[model samples]
Target chain A: MNIIVCIKQVPDTTKVKIDPETNTLVREGVESIINPFDIYALEEAIRLKEKIGGNVTVLTMGPPQAAEVLREAIAMGADDVYLLSDKAFAGADTLATSYTLSKGIEKVGQFDLIICGKQTMDGDTAQVGPEIAQKLGIPVVTYVSKIEDIENGQIKLKRMVEDGYEVIETETPLLMTVIKEINEPRVPSLRGIMKAKKIEIPIWDASDIGAEGEKIGLSGSPTQVVRIFAPEVSKEGEILEGEPTEIAEKLILKLKKGKVI
Target chain B: MSIKIDLSKCTGCKLCVKACIYSAIDVVEKKAYINNNCTLCGACVSACKYEAISISKKKKTAFDEGDYEGVWVFAEQKQGKLAGVASELLGEGRRLADELGVKLSAILLGEKINGLGKELIFYGADKVYIVDSPILKDRLDETHADVLVQLIREHKPEIFLAGATSFGRSLIPRVAATLETGLTADCTGLAIDKENKFLLQTRPAFGGNIMATIICPNKRPQMATVRPKVMKRAQRDDTRSGEIIEETILNPISSRVKLLGFIEELSDKVNLEEAEIIVAGGRGLGKADNFKLIHEMASILGAAVGASRAAVDAEWISYAHQVGQTGKTVCPKLYIACGISGAVQHLAGMQTSDYIVAINKDPDAPIFDVANYGIVGDLFEIIPVITTKLKEINGG
Candidate 1:
């Protein structure tokens, strides 16, 4: 049972601030942490490895600094780490990024399972995992919250939907994007951290993974960000400031006036 | 592509250097420099205080405007019932089609769902393209994408719209990728650019702090997934009539994944997307146990319970009840937000609700900006009274 987990380093969105004048994200002074959702993918991978004897390799595509997240995964018991970084991989959107990741996975050789977070906080696009699976020509299950059973080259999962959860079964060598409800991620122990510090994470470039230059970066991405601006705030509504009882009375009256009650 | 920095405006704050996730920007001698690793993602451009950064111009791709034709909407259905978002897309698609002087068509795919074609026509579709088969009963992402891609390739529409529901979000992206077209996700606003007849797709980005209007100038069949509840549903008119065209799909590809069964969350029987009223709690409730007040108020009003991401992250509520950018987008008739300070992400999800009533201790909470009626008081004291008063009005 070989498993590969994909992770990314993202800005702590809650701490992110937008500059009013420039209408851009103020990334300065913000902490970069593993995408909260990816932690669950890492945990699930390690748990699967512990249940069935196998190797777990963590993969990521970002700048050199993204290696920090790879090391974090290794500290959490990943057997190997691969960093897909290159100047050519810059400005890649979900499509191009997933293409590059698939190429990297091909370079890493055989794997029975690939796991990813449902989505990244910054990108908020859950398209990459499924797109990667498509690029690899494998089946994918997104928004998986629970792994019910795994045996005989098949795994059953509980996937989240709009109304409820659907039970799904897929063969091995498949891809799955997990949600936070999947499992609790374990903290790395002192010994694990020490081991992580000593392990050498192999960095793969575009050519090293047999990626075509035209399909690896900004040139490969179809979507483009033409303009970004602050969202126009709607007109301020009436605020009734008073004691709890008076405020409640005023709110009720307003609701009644609006015929909302 | 990279952003150019103006040395004259740089203050040596080094903020851009810190903000660069790729470590492409470096500060030296009171100035910031960008290297080859920059992707021009615009994070540092927004972080720079001196207005020192600007993205380089892009080469525009040529597209033939005359080749594209109709405006199409994906009428996504589940269990033979039309999702409300599908109707909403039809309403919006009609507006775009009218602007373009083209027919507004709908693509309805399901098992034995021929009756739904008329329902779509009643809404606004000028033509309903139906593809009925038992193989289409369950949503297989690959099979659906393949079918839609084939339809799109055969009949080229100018603009294609779908709901940003789970199905749409999953299906559209794959189709777009396969077709090598561009797609904008979770759009809050859609309009036809009269000058170019291009779809102007606007969506919230950067945790809802900003809105980005995206265009796919070179791609035919421009696609976008609009968030549910952001657009009005088309008014049903039984007197209206339209063409119903049945299409045939050849031997469908088998899906690698298999659906076994569905398990409903016992505690969350109230579907938030369809709920008429919602009572949501936030971190201001102080503790997980305090959520009982929210549930009590919702129960009295026959509303569903919703929670802010903070509450959901704290494990006070299940993810199913979360209302935010990452959670479910809802537009109930009445949204009673208790103790919610209203982060941008949370506001993005519920701002479209018809009537918003915010209760919080802080008068300056951002929630008040969008609330139709706001109460500046302790939610602990106000929520119970509102519940009691509503009970009294009902003669309980």
Candidate 2:
């Protein structure tokens, strides 16, 4: 079975800060890293490839420097890497993103399974995976915590539910976005790191992916961001100071005032 | 643009209808239906489970020429107390209202909700629209949406804002979808473009990887849901007041969804949402035996015990205690990071905490920068001493 894993390079959020004047993120000095959840997807894909005996190709969409993550993916055991980078691909929302990625996937040829992180860290909108599935007309299982089985063109996995878990079975060539519980990603070995140095990552632009320009970036996106400002911080917190019982009584009194109880 | 519904594919799952904060979808005869009352908002697209709903304009209609101006905030209250988030939205709504040079109105929908409008005025609402009814006693999605949608149509607001709480998140989407405008969720930021009076909704997307600004340029009354704690509550002025316009429901629908005595769930579950001090440990604790140290420290300080993805993955603690993007998003007052290297995935969850304190052997740990206080030492050593000192300070 051939597997394709999609990942993105994101700003290390610890250093991410909003410019006080512009109300925009200050991306200049912020460091970038492979999205953490995507690492689990990469690891799971590599493990599946090892078990079933096949190749794993890692894919990413970002600036030119994003190729670094693809090299890192190669060091982690991916056989090949593809970077979809272009000015046209920039500023894409989830819709535009899913569209571009779908075109990239189509351009890359066929695969038995497509793996992705449940959601990217930079944008918490978990819509892209499902949206990509819809745009590609493929079934998507998200928040997958564990893989139960894979055999005879069929795959089974345990999906995380609100309360417990649901075991789901689907056919091959299916797309799955996994949570961190899927597997622990392995560190790149010395030999693999050396190999990654020589590996060339192919870059794809909007045209290479056969994507319509109207559907990409800000223009292609139906939603437009008008402004971004820090949320107002309001506090009139009543500190329930004392023992547990005393605090609880004070809390109950406060809740009573708010009519929360 | 008008709303369109292919009722054949609709199973009346109510997911779309419920997804709509607007009460736009009327499930009659086991099929979903929409009337001319819809605002043609596309929010129902995200709500539909069966891909049965779509939004477009109807052939021809009047009421299209009205200046859909002004920014309106629903001054939500429970047990006669205005929610803190309501005041927060007002500070934002006031900016939008001033930018547009349009009136800022607060629609108070509740039973005996008259006097509350004055408080909204002091908070920045220029006018208060009071929709008082016994049916509006408690916050029910169906009744509340019905009243809100009615208010929006009768008094056209160019922009609408609500708190991204359980109530605001639930109510606003339906209202926006019913109105057929765009609704952005859990927005971390908001701004007004003075040129067109457009309300820019900026929210963290891709799990906080990027900030996305969503605008409903063509749609009237662009709506957004802002999360609490992300914004400051407007300063209250008992001195400042405004005009109260009492609005009675001209024709109320007999409610189908009944209020079965509200049984507040008393699980004694730690409300990590409002936790001031959080002491979180991770896998570096070595074993489940080490968790005791973390919990002991947490108990001593009346703080909650949060675990890293590593510790949660190791099954050393419950998933609820796990703090990360996939686990829980917390912004506690004081977050004590122990043994966590501050991996990007792990930090996304609790980085919003007010004053962070990091205690780890690695001075290079990423959690330090965000932390107001940093201890470059072993968590095992630091926790015990801190707990002992806290006990002494409290005379425990």
Tell me the RMSD of model 2 versus the true structure.
16.4
Error of 1 at B334 (Å): 3.3
Tens-place lDDT digits, model 2, residues B249-342: 8777543333333222232234454455678888669887898888877786678778898888788876657777767667766777788887
Go through the candidates in order and give each one's C-alpha lDDT.
0.84, 0.69
Q: lDDT by residue for model 2 over A122-211, one digit each (tens)?
A: 566555665565466555666777788899877777765322445666677777788877887899999999999998789998888888
Candidate 1 vs. true structure, TM-score = 0.91
lDDT: worst 10-residue window of model 1 chain A: A17-26
TM-score of each: 0.91, 0.55
Q: How many backbone collisions does model 2 have?
A: 45
lDDT of 2 at A35: 81
Those runs of model 1 whose alpha carbons end farther than 4 Å from true positions after fitting are: A233-237, A243-245, A259-261, B1-32, B43-65, B284-290, B313-316, B343-354, B362-372, B394-396
DockQ of each: 0.57, 0.06
Interface RMSD of 2: 13.7
Pull out the clashing pairs in model 1.
Answer: none
How does the DockQ of candidate 2 come out?
0.06
